[model samples]
Structures are given as C-alpha cells and as structure tokens.
Target: MAGSRVLFFEHTLSIKGFDKALEALDWMKEEMCKEKGFSRHDGGDYYDHLVATAQDLLDVGIKDEDIIIACLLHDSVEDVEGITVKMVAGRFGENVAHMVDLVTKKPGVDYKVGDNLKRYLEAISKHPGASLIKTADRIHNFGTLKNATPEKKLRQALETEKYFIPFFKTCRGAHPRYAKYFFRAKTTIEPHLWEIKEHYEEIEQLRDQLRKQERTA
Candidate 1:
C-alpha cells in the first residue's frame, strides 16, 4: 500500500519535474500528519481521497499525468495542514498550485453555510480539475458519514443531493472519460443517503415524542 501510494505520488510529481514534486510531496506528507481530518492508517486524508478519485480516472483511461497529479494535490493546499497555494506553486509550479487553488475554500468568509456550499459547487462546475477533486472529497465524506452526529449526517446528505450530485453530473458531461466512475459513485451513495435521511427523521420523531411525554407528565 505504501508503495502504491509512493507510485501515485511519483506519477503526479512527474508532470511538474521529479525532484521539485518530490519536495512538495514530502512537505505534503508532513502536512497530512498535522491536519485534523487525516486518518493515519486508512488513508482518509483529503489527499488520499483525491488519490482514490485519480485512481478511478486512471482506470477509465484518462492518462494525463498533470490531471492525475492535479487530482492528487487538489486539496493539499486548500485543506491540508498549514500549506498554501503559493507554497505549492513555488515548489511544484503554477499549474499544480492553480488546480489546488481552484478547489480551496477561503477561510472565515462569513457567509452562511448554505451560501458557502453553493459558491463551492459553482466553483467546481467552472473547473474540471476542481470538480474531480470535489467529487472525490464528497465520496470520502459520504463514506465517513456514519461517524457523524445525526444532525450532521442529515445536513451532509442534503448537501450532497442538492449541490454535489448536479455538479458531478456536469463534470461527467464535460469529461466523458470519468462519466462511468462518477455515475457509479453516485449510484452507490444515493442509497446510503436515503438510509441516513430516514435515520435522522426517526431520531427527530423520538425526540419529539419524548418532549410531548414530558409535557404531559
């Protein structure tokens, strides 16, 4: 698994020049360790999610090394620990950094969560590379939703249906090679979302019943 991980990293780094990309990759490894959401054994870091998506692209015959690398590094600058797009660009070159920048959300924008999600979906629709990474991010997030609170799980499901599904559909139309994987991922996830939605409703009803019983008592 480690070898496969290294090969994927090398494959991505090869597009921008081996040594420079290696340095950036090393920095990224350190950053991944520091990041809050990264999983040590499961490869559940945002970068790992991107890698999984890139693997799907590879399986579908999309062999653009830059795109693959871009997919891998897509969330590194934006969501990883203490890394910046400028640093990625300076180390790995502009194209890679630009791809990362496209997907990175600005910190503390003060918008409502709904508005921020909308803006993010719009940004992904406008850029294929960003869309690719975002799709992978959603997939990983949905996969992990079982660990989240009932309220959070419901919100995530609604967000995926409302924002990500359409964006993934748009991305599929724009990038035909990835269409199959995107659809397959969507198909697998929809059922899970339905289950989560039902679970949330049941929890809410239980809470309501408890409140009513308390009032009567």
Candidate 2:
C-alpha cells in the first residue's frame, strides 16, 4: 500500500468542452480571413470554407474536440506565412496542433509538388482524425474547384479519385455512421465530377504555356 502511492487519470468528453473548441474556431477563422484561399478575392471566402470543412467533420461523426480544433486550424499554417505549428500547439494543446501539423503542407520549396503531395497523402493516411479532416477539406474544395484554372481543376479531380476517394473510404470505415454522412456530401458533388474533364483542351494549352515558361526559366 505504501509503495502504491498514487495513480490517477482523467477522461475528457468533446460534448463537455466543445464550446471552447468553437471559440478556437473563431480565432482560426479570423486569422484565415486576413489571408487568401486557393487564390485571391476569387477565393474570397475562407471563413465560409473553413466553416464548411468543420461542418463536414460534424456530419461525419467526428465530435472529438481536438480533431474539430484541428479542422479549424488546418490551413492556417500552410497558407499563412507567419503562422506556425508551435503557435497552434501553444494555443490549442499539442494534440490538436500535432493533428493540424500532420496535414499542413510545408512551405513552398524547390522540390516537386507531385512528390510532396504523395508524401502528404501518405502521412494523412496514418492518422484517422487527420484523414477525416482532409477528406472534408477535399469534399469542400471539390465543390469550389470550379474557381481554379481548368488545368488545376482537372489535376485535382484526377488526384481526388486516385488518392482522396480511397482515404475517404478509410475514414468511412472508422465509424459505423460515417459512411452514410460522407456519401450524402459525395452525392452533391458527384453531379459535378463530369465537369472537371470538360476543359481538357484549354487546360492542355495552359499547361503547354506554363511548361514553356518553366523551360525558359
């Protein structure tokens, strides 16, 4: 008994602390508002985008407060130059920061985007919460991909089918209720999937132009 001095543990519930998580969501939105999304004023509404991603998580049965917090902060580190993973960890707790950090792509460098994206996808696949957030991120992004250049949209669609749909399926398997909710959002976007290929000719021309420019540089 003397040797068994002390051992204690605590359990936390999302339902209990989720209100605080919403407050962090507001903070993340404000930071993102000062930044651009996929592009400038055209991507004018990051707040809406972040909210939509969060809503997707909610719909998919991800009620963990930290995961929800990660959803709100996902893009901030990737898109906003000054923001750092440490800052998020400091504010939201390391668990939330680590999840967000897992999904945040590193700042641009000379390396190939394709290779980086493959690595990014691999990392996301390892974490259930990260996978869930990314799937929501892609689902919302697909809805808005029309705002991207034809080439960009086509590339994204191909990648989504190649990589993301599989990850979404994994997320779907994580919970019994998730497949239904995830597919409900998927149905809304399935109607638009055909359009991603509509501008192949234009996209190819744009790609040729960019390739020529790259070669010249």
Candidate 3:
C-alpha cells in the first residue's frame, strides 16, 4: 500500500469502533482536501500521527478507550472549520467529544498565536488526555519545521525547547504511560531545536559585531 493509504488504514484500525471513526475520518479528509496550503494538509495528517501515538500509549499500558479516541480526534475540531465537539459528540458519543472540546481553542479569540498557545497549554494542564494529544500534535509539528523559513524555524525551536519541553515534563508526571513517546518525539526533534538555537546565537553575535564596528567607525 502507498504510505499515506497505509497511514490511513493504520489510523482506522486504532479507533475503538473502526467503522464509525472511519466515517468521521473520511469526512475530515474530504473537508481538508478542499483547502489550500501545506499547513492544512499537515493538520489533516495529524489523524495518522495521533493513531500512531495512540498505539504508543497502548504499548505503555494506557487502556482507556476514551483517551485513545481523544488522541485521534483531538485536533479535528480545532483544525477543521465547521467541525465541532458537539458534532463529534452527536456522531461519536460524549466522552470522546468532551475530551476534544477541552483541547479545542475557541474560534476567533484574537489573541496572538503565542497567547493562544499559552491558553492551550493551560487547558492541557487540567486534563491528562488533552495533554497527551497536545504532546502528539507538537511532536508532529516540530518534526516538520524544516519546511519553514530559518527565522520562523528558529523561533519555533526556541518555543519548543523553552515552553513545550517543560510542559511535556509536567505531562510525564501525570501520564507516565505517555512519557516515553513524548520523550522520544522530543529527542527526535532536538537536533532541529539545537540547530535553530545555534543559528540564533550566530546571528546575535554577528549583530553585536556590526554594532561594535559602527562604534569604532
């Protein structure tokens, strides 16, 4: 099978009610296919990553169906417009939907992305399932930062190292079953993070040198 198709298949198998989640996944895939940009595509692909991470959770001994479903659908409501937790609940049942809702940021809140991210982290602190999905989402996102501009990449790496690293550490304390996957994901992305850090340091040193040259001139 093609890699994407294989991914989709694996994702479908991970859901508790395979047929129902497949129905929702098909709807999500269709909705996302009509959109433009890599981010949208990347966001849609989150379903696959979520499934893989769900398997990781199972490997670590997490046995809750709701938590697993929550991982699969966590980003669906947030990233796909017109999709809501109420709709998911109506279709999939309440517990799965509630977990998704807890992780979904409100639409059009007008805060800077950073502030919105902070709000998301705060919400996750109170919900272990939400935190698990958040960690999975971050891992997928961080793994893709090479597609962005150097400056943007640097900023993202710094944010991950500074904010998300510690956040995942706290998540470990609560959801130890998820910690290994979280740490593995973090480790996979650390090289990029360090690359960005080193690049930023180089730029700052150059800027300082330019200032000193101007003063000497």
Candidate 4:
C-alpha cells in the first residue's frame, strides 16, 4: 500500500524534469521549515501542500525551473518574517524571486481579508505565472477543506467558488488539458461544502430547540 501510494505520487511529479522538480521540493521542505507556518499551518504538512502545488505546476507543463522553484517558495516571503523578495532573489536568482514576488501578498496593506483576496483575483491578470501557482494553491486548499472548521469551510468554499473558480477557468484557457483535471477533482468539494452548510443549519435548529426548552423550564 505504501509503495503504491508512493508510485501514485511519483507518477504525478514525473511530468518532465522530474529530478529538478523533486530537488526543488526538497529545497522547499528545508526552507519552509524556517517559516513559522511550517509546523503551525492549520493543514498539517504545509510543506507537503506546496509540494503538491509544485507537482500540479509540473503536471501543467510548467517546465521553467524558475517558475517551479517559485511555486515551491510561493508562501515563504509572505509567511516568513525577514524573508523578503530581495532575499529570495539573492539566493534563488531574480527570475525565481520575481515569480514569488508576483504571488506574495504585500504586507502592511490594510486590506481586509476579503479585500486582500480580491486583490489576488484582480492581480492575476497582470501576472500569469503567479496565477498558475495561485490556482494550484487554491485547488489544494478547497480540496482538503474538510479539515477546516465548518464556518471556515463555508467561508473559504464560497470565496473559492466565487473568485478562485474563475481563476481556474482563466488558467484552463491557457493550459486546457491539465486544468480540466483540476476542476474535475474539485467536484467532490461541492458536496463537502453542502455537508458543512447542513451542519450549520442543524446546529441552529438544535440551538433553537434548546432555547425553547429553557424557556419552558
């Protein structure tokens, strides 16, 4: 079972330039560990999540080594204190850092969470490479959202359906073959979201029943 699982994962990463991609993944694991989210991100194994995103990029024929490496480090500059674009450029080369910069949300911007999200939605047009990474990131986020709180699940699911789904559509236009599977894979999440939505209604109903019982008592 373990071997089969490894093969399943390996096949996905073997799209092209497998060795380099895998090495970049290793670098990501090492560098991401330096970020606080490495151990603390709500989703266990955020490093693995980025690896999955990198594989998604590879599967989409993103053979540009810089872009692949950028995919691996997409969150580092944002999540890691003192990890600036210049730092990334110094170490990873300008092209790789540029891609990471394109995706990293600017800090100190007072945009609300929803507004920041909106910024990403609007920014992707000017940065197609960043958009590719964002699409892959969103795929993993919504795909694994069962682990999120029901409220979180609903909020993220709605945001994804509203903003990220269209982002996926744009990416599909560029890489139709691979992007098709991304949306196909997300078919499961809709039901997952519905399930969470029902949980909310059920809780409200039970709360109402409790209030009526208390009033009677």
Candidate 5:
C-alpha cells in the first residue's frame, strides 16, 4: 500500500515551502532518464526509488522537511552527472545539501574494499539527519532486493548484518528522537536478511548434495 502512496511532484510541491523541492526532483528525474539503462533492479524508473525513499521517511513520522527533501535527491550527487553539493545548496539551502553530501559515496572509494566503507558509514553516523535518510534509503533498497541477482542479494544481506545492524543499534542511542523508528526499521530489515541468508544456505546445500551424487554416480 505504501508503494501506491508515493508523494508525487505535484503533491510535494504544494506542501508549503516544499515547492522548491520539486526543482531538485525535476533535476533528478531528468538526469536519471538521460542516463539510459538507469533503473531499479526490478526495472522500474529510478526516480520512483528516490520518491519511495522520501515516502519511507514520511511514513515513519519524520517531520524534518529538509530531511525529506534530502531523501528526494540523496542519490543525485553520487549517481547523476554534473550534480554537485554547491548546486544542491544553491537551490535547496545548505542543510539539505549537507545531508545529501554526507550520504554520497566519495569518489575513488571502493565501498566493498578496505576501510572505505567504514569511514563512509562513520561519516553518516556522525550526522543524525543523514543517517535518518540513509536508513530510509536502505530500507527501500533491501525491501526491493528480491528482484536482484542472487549474488547481489547475498552481498547485501551480509553487508546489512556486518554494518547496518550495528549502525541501527547505535542510532537508538544517538538519535533519541528517532529511536523507535530506527528500531522498527531494524526489526523489519533483519528478518528479511535472515530469510535471504537462509535461502542461500539452502542453495549451497543443494549444490553440495549434487556434487556428492555426481561423485557417487
């Protein structure tokens, strides 16, 4: 039901000062569309994913309008060509831009290798607003990961267990105003990760069984 309730550009623009947020959304949509083949794992429009991320924040009772705006454009700097923090600041004010910058992965940093990921998570954790939006973003990502490849699904599940679970735990203490929401997100995400992990284990077992049968035959 939440999927069907996405806050469209028209609806969001009417929300008082959020009219400016439509500019960011427009820019994001244009850039994402221009980058042909850009899409969710399920082949849905990528802009839909951004809208869903913002809606997740709202559904969880987040009242910080800037955070919502940040969510709407969070991936722009990272995934969109020529988008920059300064560009975001000029349009949406500094706080929203700062939150977006905080979540964007730094250039040349391989998140799956070495300390890059740790430092990235640390930066986000230091800013509660960024962490809030990042959490919502991941919640959407994990929820829709069923359409992802098995390798990607396993990798995400493992990463969530290794990094996100602990991060969400700390958020309860560090972001008191949002603790309950973080907890709810954690509870929802963990079970799904468990299911993925279990599914993979079953697959591995079946592979082993087939190998043993082949040798015996």
Candidate 6:
C-alpha cells in the first residue's frame, strides 16, 4: 500500500440506516466526482476521503446523525461551486448544514496560512461537534498523506503540531464524551508529523551532500 500511487483506507465496519445521511453521502460523492477543479492530491477519489473521515468518526464511537452527515459533506460548500449552506440545510437539516459551514474555510482566505489558520481553528472550536468532524477529517487526511510533495507534507505536519495538537487537547476538556477519541486522534497524527519531518531532514542532508560534492569537484 505504501508504494501504491494512491493509498486507500480499509475498514470493514459500517453503519446502517440513516438514509438521509446516506443520501447526503451519495450527493457529495456525485458532486465531488464531477467537479474537475477539486483535487485530492492523494491520487484517490474525493468521495473516498469523505467516507474514510466518516468512518473515522464511527471508529471512535461517534454515531451522531448530523455529525456523520457533516463529515460526508463538509467540503461541499467550499469545493463545489453551486453547493451552499442553505441548500445543505434544506436537504439535510440545519444541524448538518451548520456543522459543515463551520468547518468550511472562508472565501478567498488561505486557511492553511498565517492568521487564517488560527481563525479557522478558533471558529471550529466554538462548536464541539464541528471540531470533532474536523479532527476526524485531519486524521484521515494525514493518515493517507502519501502522494503529496515533501514540502506540503512537512508544512501540514508542522501546522498540525503547532495548532491542531493543542486544539485537540482543549477539545478533550470541553467534550468529555469524545476525550478518548481525541486523544487517540492526537496520538495517531503526531507520529506522522515526526515521520514527515524526519523524511524532510534526510532529503535536506542528501541535498547538502550533493552540493558539497559539486563544490569539491
């Protein structure tokens, strides 16, 4: 799996019923597949990430209907041109829509850079359920971080360390029911950061060695 062009998340467990949530998943899968602009960077289908994220939630024993639906559609408002918070509300109810909106980055702002990242994390902290969904999203994202450029992998791992680690810690306090799951997520993600950072360091070392050889020649 590590050598494959795309990494797949495999889980045998699935939740049944919740037809509306499944309906929302179908809707998101269709939209994500058709949208030429959306990029997964992991060389996998966008819908796979959504299902993996929702599965992460279920793995941690979070079976809330709205949160699950939010996990399925969290990126729709941001990535799909025609999808709106209002449209999501009309179809899946306000709770799902609201959580999705809360996690969606603001328009024209690069949520991964500068103060935008901080503000995005802060906004998500206001809603515990939204925070959990975001955490699950990150866990799945980083867990499958195989095909991205080394720079992206390093920067994102650093961001997760500096911002998301403490954010998860704080969430543990406010969301007692999810505390253990948050801890598990934190542990799961931290090791990836270390691995990426180490890989980056090794690359820099090789670059330095090559530069030295060129200079001596």
Q: Write the per-residue lDDT of candidate 3 for residues 1-217, one digit (tens) a residue.
A: 2246536555645554555655655554455443533132334444455555555555556666677667767767877777788898988899788788877777777434777777767778667777776776777667766666776787778788877887777777776766786677678778878877988899999999999999999
> For model 1, how does the per-residue alpha-carbon lDDT over 1-217 read when each residue is reduced to its tens digit?
6558767656755654645445545555666642655663445544455556666655656655556666667667656666788877776678777777877777877434778878767776676666666676677668866566777778888878887787778778886766876787688789998898888788889999999999999
Model 4, position 117: C-alpha lDDT score? 73
Each prediction's RMSD over C-alphas, in Å, is 4.0, 11.9, 3.8, 3.9, 2.1, 4.0
Measured by TM-score, the strongest candidate is 5
How many clashing residue pairs appear in each of the predictions shown? 0, 0, 0, 0, 0, 0
lDDT of 6 at 158: 90
Residues 116-173 of candidate 6: C-alpha lDDT, one tens digit per residue: 8888887887787899999988898888778887778888899899899988987888
Q: Which pairs of residues collide in candidate 6? A: none
Candidate 5 lDDT tens digits, 64-131: 77888898889989987888999999988999999999999988888997367777877798888899
Worst 10-residue lDDT window for candidate 5 reads 1-10
Worst 10 residues of 3 by lDDT: 33-42
Model 1 collision count: 0
After superposing candidate 3 on the true structure, give the runs of residues whose Cα lies further than 4 Å from its correct spot: 1-8, 11-17, 34-65, 108-116, 210-217
Question: Which of 1 and 5 is the better model by TM-score?
Answer: 5
Candidate 4, lDDT over the whole model: 0.69
Per-residue lDDT of candidate 2, residues 53-96 (tens digit): 77666655676878877887888888877889898988888898
Model 4 lDDT tens row, 1-217: 3235334555666655456556656665666653644752354556777767777666656767776778888888888677789987887788778888878888687444777777766676355677677777777777776556667777876777666666666666765545655465457456765676787789999999999999999
Model 6: residue 21 alpha-carbon error in angstroms: 0.5
Q: Estimate the overall C-alpha local distance difference test score of candidate 3.
A: 0.68
| Range of the 10 consecutive residues with the lowest summed lDDT in candidate 2 | 2-11
Candidate 4 Cα misplacement greater than 4 A, ranges: 1-23, 34-37, 40-44, 110-113, 173-182, 185-188
